[model samples]
Target chain A: MSLHAGQHPSTTAAPDATTGTRDWLIASAAAIVALIALYAVFFDNGSLIAATGSYLHEFAHDGRHLFGAPCH
Target chain B: MSIPVLPLLGRGLTAGGAAGLTAGLFSLLLAEPLMDRAIRLEEARSHEHADSGAAAVQHHEELFSRSTQHFGLVVTSLVFGLALGVLFAIGYALVHRRDPEAAPWPRALLFSGAAFLAVSLLPALRYPANPPGVGDGATVAERQGLWLAAVVIGVLGMVLVWQVYVRLAGRSAPVRQLAAAGTAVAVLAVLFALPGNPDEVPVAATLLWDFRVLSIASHALLWAVFGVVFGALGLRALGRTAAPAPSGAVPAG
Candidate 1:
């Protein structure tokens, strides 16, 4: 038998969950990294709530213009 | 300019910085399944002695997704990392308030946060707060084109070097591994230029907009982590991988 099952791939059990969790761990780690960058940006404003509110506005309203012209 | 403090004591600048660092570092740490699958597909197609550019490009796209995901992972990680640090310390300090001797490490956030700030600031400190895209910015469209060109040249030069290193690496390594470190210094300078001028008020959209003085440390450290991890992981993954078996050993279906 081939290593692959039919076009409908042979699924492995549990490893998928573990892998998903691993990805979650990776995402968790990424979230931390994002915070650190944010902290660096907002250290003068230690008030997290204030800084976050500011960021929300920046992200939602104006990131692409500020970062660069969109790829398109 | 260097961040006042943070990296010296804390794990990272922000929750996100820590997570981004981890993600960047871990992307360095883990194998890229996306890349691996693409390579396998490439091999299978190539073994047929066919020139399937589409397959090759599709593989490239897969690699790019992994690469961009790796970048996003870095971004999200940094966001979470800082949050966690603040939360952790506050929680610790509160729980152990009765015992002043255990104040939790106050210095941690400063050091990590400073490091993260340094990363962004050092690169962009010299750059004008308002530049290029912003209104009444220093560079008009034509002038910005020149600066952007210079930046591209400098970056592309480094990227070429990185490409060599990656090729020496296993096929599974992701792209943009070079982009972070390569563009770090220049990006900082340019971003700085964008915001200082009042005309560039809209420039706020481009930046994190939290606009804290400390961002300098976070950005610098973020890339520092990126370069170091990419170097380490690329090497390790290559070392462990077994070369594919010689052709004709396994017949195709």
Candidate 2:
């Protein structure tokens, strides 16, 4: 979205505005999740190799079945 | 006999691309839209006493920026995701004559930097702006989003380490924090030994311990943090202007 130079999503994120500790918990959770996501995306994990196994397995034997499943 | 390694390399390449694409798409579907909404909400409410016309136009601009930024994130993830692994593989092959899993910090950082370049740069972004909009209360969204992206990008580490981060923040006990950290590392080791399935362990199950723990929940979390850090550092690199850049024109300062 069109934002000012100094303003961005990270800089501008807000709480749910509800009264409770919910905002704090969500903010804290979001923080934790985002960090690991960065790790998975950029880091060299054995999981990619695992993903490869699944990808190939699905692509070769299960694409026909799995393809429709996601759609359905 | 001739190309024994080619097929292996091919599999790795395909896997990397698939992982990157899936991650990028997930960002688009889940993370991008949230940020898009924030940008609209921010810009629409920017004026002191503006009419609906200003808000509508601002919303459109926000949309345009979000649409492009969404795609930019996808593409950047693909390039960075694949390159990240490849760069280290090559570097490790040269230096230690093998993979560089031994140095965890360097491994995390090396690829994180890869994202810092492609995802962080404005021109590489398909969005009108490199960083997405921050409207009223946008900073809060920015912080949540950027950190979420980091968690998502980091995946296992986020789920594993964040309990420690939060617990330590809340409890403020060093020994307990160390105990938590050790438990996380142990769990990670067990997971690795099991092999395959990045999303195999349900974050929900993990969240049985804590609710807010998805590594890649929001695209903006990482970017927002970058914006805050960069904005502070960039203040000196730039001259200050009291006013927001005017409509239908770029910022002069």
Candidate 3:
């Protein structure tokens, strides 16, 4: 038997269009969630969570500094 | 083998939570005291300015007490880690798609290392973390914009170098490595061209340096733990799904 043959039996089948689409969707969703979280943690200056007051800013304040986010 | 994305994502979240908790606890013990000192110093400076009639200092009461904010720090770290974990999973899935034969553990660790470099280290080098009293309030927005620009550039540079490395796979290993390094150096030269922080360091050198050091240490811990935990988790997950190799096909460790 060839060395490369059946090496990845479970994943040997070619990925279909559905699998590609699903992967793309998952990646896009993950990217969106990551961006929102990054904003809340690093860049929010009382704007994103203003409705809750400066609570989010204050809460993430220490983390902002520690993680080297621009904070004053 | 092509692993499912969801399972990898789950592992990423779990590993990220663990890494975040570790980093949170570390900051709580080590970085918090330094922050307290910086805040006090800031308050003192404001009072001095007020006394001299240099500027009107508004003494707005903190909505949450210091202790409350301290508690929130851990929560923030945890959330940040979770978010990073999600991104990590997505990144791994994308790279793995292109190179399924690479070992999971090394790939995960290398990925996290690259992230730390792009997200934390490069930005910090360009715009070091300042304590509470250090930066000018008026320039905070500009400084933030600059920092974000640095991070974006660093990440893009990393991606570009990775593409270069991948493209040179058919070449000799040394040639491939050299091309990657040259690409990285070219990227760093671009990063060097970004504008500097607008705020000047008015604080004492010792305090500023110490605080910056501790801040970086905390970040380093977070990434280090993240890499280790993510690698272990990914390896185990891969092991579970990996098929038995045909005789003589299994590569020796």
Candidate 4:
């Protein structure tokens, strides 16, 4: 069936609570992961990535500088 | 029916990633080589300084070769593009939430331009791009602090301008024009008030100018392409779902 034809039923149908919860949970997880990656790319100078010993620093070197983040 | 948010976000991501690739190609071809040359000149200058009895800058291990760095540049650009695209979609949805009569293409383009100003241009005015090996090592933290502060202030200032613009949107054209001018002046005043970080790298003026120009050009390309591509895709997605109102429809009270 065409999307236009089915639009009425879909629009009128109530969203599933469980599905909504699952979507929200997945989105939250993805967001958290994204935030961590952001920190690593933009802010993790040394303290967070101490175990790696500057690998992250060197990897995101150009980006950090491009964004005007301090990397000397 | 109301426009769905998730599909719009997904479309934005796809468009954004494609735009990123295009922008990345431009950077790799035009800007990366210039950056590489700047790095070489910086290395030579550092060596001369060492011979003149100054302490040599410490060299880090080569995590990747020059070619790899170039390739990595493309990947990084794509990732950033994807992130930026998603954020743009979210902002677009929020902006159009109550307006049922809004068109997608123009709205997307406007938002993209505003985003470019907020994210790239504003902070850049305070601390413009510098090639690698240009900044002082000791002042990295201080420079970063100042840069982040400028970005935060710039974004907040734009938000204020947007609010003012929306409020004045219903007024007469003259009033709207005055409001726009007022907002621009206010934002410019704040931006000018921010301290400009002085360049510390011992690079030549010509090289510095070239690098800065290329960097700005790359960003401009990225944003312009993003706006165009996202606008196109967003219009398609929203248009597909938008049902036309019936002709001569009576109000169903």
Residue B125 lDDT (model 3): 87
For DockQ, the strongest prediction is 3
Residue range with the least summed lDDT across 10 consecutive positions in model 1 chain A = A63-72
Q: Which of 1 and 4 is ahead in lDDT?
A: 4
Q: Go through the candidates in order and give each one's C-alpha lDDT.
A: 0.35, 0.34, 0.78, 0.68
lDDT of 1 at B233: 33
lDDT of 1 by residue, B33-111 (tens): 3223434544565455446434332212222333554344344445444554443333222323333111113323333
TM-score of candidate 4 versus the correct structure, residues matched by position: 0.84
Instruction: Give me the displacement of residue B145 in model 3, in angstroms.
Output: 1.5
Q: What is the lDDT of residue B105 in candidate 4?
A: 64
TM-score of 3: 0.88
Candidate 1: residue B245 lDDT (0-100): 16
For candidate 3 chain B, the 10 contiguous residues with the lowest summed lDDT are B244-253
Q: What's the ranking of the predictions by DockQ, best on top?
A: 3, 4, 1, 2
TM-score of chain B of each: 0.25, 0.35, 0.89, 0.87
Q: Scoring model 4 with DockQ, what do you get?
A: 0.34
Writing each residue's lDDT as its tens digit, candidate 3 over B33-69 gives 9888888877887888889988955443487788887
Q: Which portions of model 3 show Cα errors greater than 4 Å?
A: A1-8, A11-16, B1-3, B56-61, B99-102, B172-174, B243-253
**By lDDT, highest first, what's the ranking?**
3, 4, 1, 2
DockQ, in order, for the candidates? 0.03, 0.02, 0.51, 0.34
TM-score of 2: 0.30
Best by lDDT: 3
